[model samples]
Target: MDSQSRVFAAILTESGREYTGNENPQRLKVQAVDRQILNNRVQEVQVTGTAEDCCPADRVSVRVSVGHSKDSVNEVTNSVSRRLEYILQVVRQHGASEKDTSVRRFLHREADKYHMDAEVLITFSDFEKMERVRSVLLEKLAKSVCVGTPQFYHSAECLSLMRRRACVSAVENAQQKACEVSQLLGQTLGHPFLVREEETREWKNEDEEDGGRCQNATRLPHPSQIPTITVSSQVSVSFTFRDISKKKPQ
Candidate 1:
């Protein structure tokens, strides 16, 4: 359906008083000369707009663990430590940075048998390399190795940047719509009185198809196939509904 722009009386107030109208009055905020004048003024316009941005999901967190069983606690711990070190070295050779790998070892005693488990958290941008690492570790460690599922996510810096861009886009949309309507009515657009966010959302799209290469036995989803991170924002903006052309010189 086609949309229509409207003109409303500009009322700037912060009395926290409840107002009754078809729209939410709390969102109608603006700098005013006087609250009494704002309430009495009859020129105002309301505009609501929405915008979104999609960023590629390049970062992924992969958790890998190895469990070893031996007759003595020392033997299990030593074996697990050696295997963990080797696994880390393999990952590093495949482009995983040392700063992104965190290792933790757990030892437990069950009767005469001792069990030791070593786990590592690896964060990187390459999904294929991660899968290769997982496969090679499983090949060497056999039954003692376990490759946990990789959880996909984006970096903080990327998401923050997208959100800010989306906000600007939403405001621009509102401004364009407002300006068009005001011109048609012979009124010049003024400074925005209020811009309040009505909705902010973040989500990942997982419906993209990558030509039968989405996932494999390593439990790593194809980065290109998975949905990218998306940010959306909706805002209700209020602008002064008046004319700059008819102003008198001071």
Candidate 2:
């Protein structure tokens, strides 16, 4: 073949096609240029951002128990019943609903006397009300009633809200950084092209580096003072860039 035909054949082979002088030989070059232009059309900036949010424990559970041993089963039942009724009443009076309170009993005979023990598990939403209930039970029943320490924790809804807030804050921080970078590059910031949560972590605030246990404390920590749950989120975001010179000023 001629020199021109040979060159065309070589280009066709490189493009993974059979040489066809009848067709446009420059088609492959045109397609390559188009691809380069398309690749340069949208420039992107990738940045990582991190943020944390903390929420105090929103629920507390307390357990109260009473037990009595008497000569007969009826005597034991009546004695335990009185204390149980009183405990339930105090809990209800403090705004706790029946659904939030659960009761369990154990009855048995040892040697000759019969024994009965009852427990009331209460979940409280209001710390002050729980304190009042605890105080009344202790003052009225005294040592007869055993009130367990309150356990504080975050509710499911509270945790869900905290996680969302942390993730959104992280994304916002990433966008802010991307905007600054684009400005430095003399480009306008466009809409985000990609967003991904790279990592997430949750732990008690007490585990923080700056936090430490208080030794020789005078009083126990209050319900509200309980260690809060801290959630942190790290996100990777890619934002498109627009030419500042081509943008119309608002």
Candidate 3:
């Protein structure tokens, strides 16, 4: 091989290293540049930061029941069926779809008297729409109707969005902390070089449901304060800093 072709070439190692050999060796080998490059990429200040917030539940479920009594099972059942149909129509008018509603029927007979009931489970994405539907059901069904308190919870999409927002806040917190630390160390803050999410946590009010206790309810459930969802995030960020004092004199 030509001596000129033996020119030094760069190589990588687990840890950056420097090689200083003969002034002009016949075969020149280049090394240690990677360590310098890696050092340039590595950040100087490391910080662990966290952020948390609570988001109100936006999804709701309302269960309604209609019941009737008559001399025959079929008669009472037909009566409840008519009321349920009316309730469904009212729900559709308020923007609910068939896919969002579930219907179930019940029957009992005793000494020529028949009792029948039908319940509808309606899922609503908007509270205003639910309020409208509830009003119509109460006005139309009157004595035979009962409306339950809306069950509040978070949807998958809502949870995902909240989690992302929490992570972003956590990163911001880490940067802020790093900036303060760099200032205390007499350094100028630079852009973050690396970020590692150490943990993500979720918390809920002990008095409220956390998407685990779900039940098919009937009759009116007394209203209480709405539940809340909280998501928190922890992140470790490596922030770059510059030594302002090290700048070359003018």
Alpha-carbon shift of residue 108 in model 2 (angstroms): 1.9
Candidate 2: 10-residue stretch with minimal lDDT: 1-10
lDDT of 2 by residue, 1-97 (tens): 0000011111223454544457765564423334344344546677788888888888878788889999999999999998899899888888999
The global C-alpha lDDT for each of the candidates, from Candidate 1 onward, is 0.72, 0.74, 0.70
Candidates in descending TM-score order: 2, 1, 3
lDDT: which candidate is best? 2
Query: Which lDDT value does model 2 have at 78?
Result: 94
Q: Between prediction 2 and prediction 3, which has the larger TM-score?
A: 2
Q: At residue 72, give the lDDT of candidate 2.
A: 100
Clash count for each candidate, listed in order shown:
9, 0, 1
Each candidate structure's TM-score, on Cα atoms with residue i matched to residue i, is 0.70, 0.76, 0.67
Tens-digit lDDT string for candidate 3 (1-250): 0000011212233344322333344444435453346445433777777787678777888888778889987788788888888988898888998988999998988677998877899999887788778777766666678787677778889889988988888888777767777777456788777888778888665454433232233333333356677888887777666634345878
lDDT by residue for model 1 over 1-250, one digit each (tens)? 1222233433334664423355675676644455455345556578887888888776777677778889988888888888888888889889998888999888888888999877888887787887788788777766666666666667888899989988878888888888887877456777887989878899877743332221225665554765588888888889886544345978
What are the runs in model 2 whose C-alpha is more than 4 Å off?
A: 1-39, 207-225, 243-250
